[model samples]
Target: MELSHEYLTENREYKDYKDFVANCKLTKPENFNFAYDIVDRYAELAPEKRALVWIDDFDDEKIFTFTDISRESKRAAAWLKSKGIKKGDTVMLVLRRRYEWWILMPALHRIGAIVIPATDQLLQSDFEYRTNAADVKMIISYDNPHVQTEIEKAKVNSPSVQYLVTVGPDREGWVSFHGEYEKCEADFPRPEGEEKTYNDDPMLLYFTSGTSGYPKMVLQDFTYPIGHIMTAKYWHGVVDDGLHLTIAETGWAKSTWGKLYGQWICGTALFVYDMNMLKPDKMLQMIAKYGLTTFCAPPTVYRFLVRQDLSKYDLSLCQRFSTAGEALNGEVFNKWFEKTGKKIYEGYGQTESTIICGNFKDYSEIRPGSMGLPNPLYDVEVLDPDGKPVPRGEIGELCIHVEKERPIGLLMGYHKNKELTDAAFEGGVYHTGDNVTQDEDGYVWFVGRKDDIIKSSGYRISPFEVESVLQKHPAVMECAVTGVEDPKRGMAVKASIVLSQDYVDRDPKEMEVEISTFARENTAMYKVPRIYEFLKELPKTISGKIRRIAIREKDNKKEDK
Candidate 1:
């Protein structure tokens, strides 16, 4: 029997998609804690089973068993507790894909403290804002020169910060993580009474990318991981005794979605490659070398992979492939499937929730450019401006039903911001702010975000649709589509493109016309970009998502000039 059967109603597998939607249910255990209930339990039962397979750029490797993880986490918990880190205290972790993160995450969870994962690319300003806003009592960092300096600079003004712990070699004014943990006794019993965590207690906090405004804290309780059972076992198609590789850093929520919770609960081993930089060829080599069975990555990674000679690598062992973060383009999807003989299953979700919709292995038919069907966990619907569900073939805001009961994995609220929380759940449902259209067959197709839609003449154009068409062209390496100021039409479609290396030196005027004609031929005339600007790179957030709002802001400044 699968390990997840303990938490799920019955066998997670279903004969068909309809069966899953109709019968799937999760049994939420009261006072649930994944660290003790799952990790420790696995250690006690199957101590020798592989839990993590880690590798670094230096070719160094470390394989951890469930028993090893339990021991290391216990030691870490003892070390942290010695420093006065207790229940309800907030701690920030900036260890990027490091093995110690695997140790510290459970350690934090076991202690009932909240874990906030952050990227190492943050600047001093970003650090200041996060530390102050979250009241971060302690920060466990990986010693990158820039990151360490920024943290020091931010610490002067951050009154809540009482401890600075670094993971590498010891430095003055910093407590060495390994140094402290090695000396601590590996015995941390689970807390009792008021100290124990419940199903509704906050376990994780994520700061949004701030694409539109200042970052808001997204808080999720201990029950969050239970929701991703659909993500790994079903949508990602993680197999029994499989070694799954999800290309994401521990800093982001995507790590929890793929690298940690769901995969572990299903008794699958995680393959982690701690690379200094992401090169397509290197990534392919790791997959082949490790004999990884299931894989998931964003559209950007697939786009890079499709450009390389895929036949050179032996990826025969990797049977399942999936993509998320952004919608998978038709061109990339087709090329990958043609080369590898596997379809790229697309899933849709956000930091606020788990996989709300996906192309599961059993039920959903693979639509080339669609987000597939909604997951059984969420009552997904496309609602219009007036909060009425739209017809099958029309576009509207995607919302989840929550008036009856908020789903297990869904966020509690934006931490300390009741006004923002109320606005998000103003209606009986929780608004996703993403716009999509559902076909008669129940397949959901992504239109751009609510703010991203462009009104040109009388047509509402989806930036994703135009971007999909442009991505098919060889000259366009990357692109962000947005609406620009046009006095007559009110808004005209504009594309900011990053040219491929082969076409980077070509005449801008000639390439612009060539790309424009290609897009016009492939897509609707109305959806074709009226204005094109070629740049070295498109503006993106720290997490590598395109910032369309930044592009529009720059265009507005130019219009004023």
Candidate 2:
């Protein structure tokens, strides 16, 4: 039986999306710890059930069962306790796609430690800020030379960090995680009384991608995993006893969304491909080789996959597909569906919440660019500035109703910043800071962020619509659309484009005209970019999200000059 059944209603299967919304219910336990309740329970029930299937670019493999996970996590818990790591302590893990990440995550949960999974691409300044802000007690990271040097530099000023552990070869001062943990006995037991974790106790912390300002810490309590039952079982469509893969590095929140909690609870073995670099061909080859049954990735990944000669790959084994992290372009979705005979279910979410809306399996009609229906877990709405719901088919800010009670999956406010928290949760709702519209069918369409919308001559333009049209053009590879200051109009729609490799040598002026023409023909004339600039690459956050705010800031500086 699927472990998710323990948290969900007795009628686990639903007739349709509406049936799901009405019948699906989550039973939240008072002292629910995922490590003890889910992982260990699976270990006891089916000890040999495959839990993880880890592989690397070099063709190395590591497979673990529920028993292995249970035993190793206990050993890891022992090793951590030996280092004085205890309940409520913040421990950052910068192990990107390393199998050790799988071990440490549950171990930290077992000890009631708050785990902050960070990207390996962070430099000294990023490390310094995060460590100080979270008051991190320990850090266990993969041994990348640059990351090692930066962490060492940051440690000088980050007095909160007491222990440094490395997953790779032994460094001078860093403790070897595998070396020490393997020697420890797996005898750590669940804590009793106040030492135990509760439903409301914080379990995870994720630093937002800081598109506008400094990254705010988003914290989730123990009940967070309970919310993702909808994400894994419905949205991603992970089949029980199948191998599921979500293409994401361990550092980001996407890992948790698909890689950990819900997938395990659904009895699906996780397939982790630790690729040092993302090559489309290799990714397809891995999927075919492993026969992964379910898959989820960002729209950017699908955009690249669609560009590949997909006919050469056998993706028949991977049945379900979904995407998030950024808005999905209609062209990309159509192309992918055409090639694979499957629709890519688009989901919308943030570091602060689980899947807010998604094209769930067996229900959603799979609108190409729509963000699908709102998840039944929260009262999702498109609201005006005063908190009233806007009429259907009108644009407004996407907000979640929290007037009566905060939902399970939503974050426990920004860590240590009550001012920002209160501002966000004011008016009895959690403002998503994203602007969108809902059709009569209740499918939500992403316009842009509150700041990302481009206004010109009394017309509001969605950068996403413009970018979707541009993406359909052959010359375009990736693009960021933003509003630039204009003397005539308050803000002009500007597009920064990275040309496709095939069109790299094309004439810039001619290519711009072709792309602009394509956009004008497909979308409203006002939505087309007034200014176009071609570049080799667009500025991006470490997680590979295009930084439109960075483009807007550069344009603002130019206007000031």
Candidate 3:
């Protein structure tokens, strides 16, 4: 399959990319399964092709061929079925990038079960909510004692949960997944009923990072894998038959974005680094040691990488780099571009969708801060609250045109929440709840989320813009800006900040004055944070996203007292 020049061009409008994106004329098969179509098909065509390369903190490494994956998944499917797992059964996975997760995911798909990926960082409360809300039946997790304790506590409340399966080591009460897999037949046939599933059958469920309330379940169908062909091939510039590493745990959606579906579909060998904890230098060393060709990570990781000396590592093999979790700061972008000639291609999406916006590989013009344009298959726009199109350079809610039909990559709906789903499309647009401004040149720049916006003294302020400015300060390591209640100004901009180790003991009041003065100098005075609180670290979600809501709640409680 030749790459489409039209779909790969940068700065092109949706119309230009649309012609080529949907032109391939691959008809949707009635009972399509990714494990069957993409993985097994590739295994049949190229049996010896390397599909996965994995290493752990203990320097243990293993390589899996396409044939190996296909065979193991069959065994896993047989084992799961023998345990009474069936079609549409919800199985929660908390395997943190273990090699077994790679096999289990496809096996679940082969059985037509919905795979819910969760991080091991989940606390007892998080497990209780997700297990009950999703009616999860079985849990397959790593043999970590902390996670085991949480699962045991949550099991009392999660009535739907019936089985506890542990990988790696045996727990007293839990079933040993590794032991069961060894005993299962390797050539067990795929269930006959799997042939009845269509392209629209729900295959994956992801819980949104609960920054506001309980996390909403975002469901994606089997067709979701088809959507990421662009993500792996173009956005990440994944080279066929080369090693690609994306730094993310299995619990996050990014794992699928880089590790599983798209990379294999593109014929690239996925690289997994299963570490107990992240060490920037150790990660750099792994890249050099493994000869990794393409790399992708969140902006927060890049920020830390920039602080380290680039010359210490031999990163010549790394040709492509990409970022997603949050918008890339211009400072990190420029520094990385300077160190490596390769530009960091920034893509945008949520747990609800695939890569919807990106700076593609074929594009020559790379904007430092723009999130590129809307993906070709998606009819995206920036609309005001009234559903009217906002003019260029004006901030508005980012929406996709649902009247035309939701794209293949989009979530089916907020699972089991019709009110939220209907509200999302009530105005004839799929509201992203994110604010953005498109430039005259057609690149979109992210503004703060609608709720994250601060209204102080009649002026609306974007927390991202303010936070970006604060990040540029030498003293600041990380920060989250939120609106706090204020009688005088409706809402006040409050910054909860973590200073660099060098500045930790320094007087916070003095640092606050400096940050305030710096913001006033760089941006409008109204946008400057009215109050600053210094901390050793900002509270973050399990996925490593800073939780502004937690800070806001703390401030509100303080004000009430």
| Clashes per model (N, Cα, C within 3 A) | 0, 0, 0
Candidate 2 C-alpha lDDT tens digits along 40-108: 998999988999999888889999998899999999999999999999999999999999898899999
Best-to-worst order by lDDT is 1, 2, 3
Which 10-residue window of candidate 3 scores lowest in summed lDDT?
2-11
Residue pairs of candidate 3 with colliding backbone atoms: none
Supply candidate 1's per-residue lDDT for 361: 82
Candidate 1 residue-pair clash tally: 0
Model 2 lowest lDDT segment of ten: 8-17
Deviation of model 1 at 140, angstroms: 0.5
**Per-residue lDDT for 1-561 in model 3, tens only?**
212222233323234433435542223456668787777877888889899998998989999998899999988988998898888999999999899999999999988999999999898889999999999999999988999899999999999998999996888889999899878886755457544567788999999886888889999998887778778876898887889999999999988898887787777899999998878899999888889999999998888887888789989998889999888878778888898666899998888888878887755367877788777667789999899999999989889887967777788998999999999888777888889999987788888677777889998887888888888887888889899888899998888889987899988888989889988899887888888999888888777777887888898899889
lDDT of 1 at 343: 92
Best lDDT among the predictions, by candidate number: 1
Model 3, residue 296: distance off in Å is 0.9
In Å, residue 296's CA in model 2 sits off its true spot by: 0.6
TM per model? 0.99, 0.99, 0.94
TM-score of 2: 0.99
lDDT of 3: 0.84
Candidate 3: regions farther than 4 A off: 1-27, 193-195
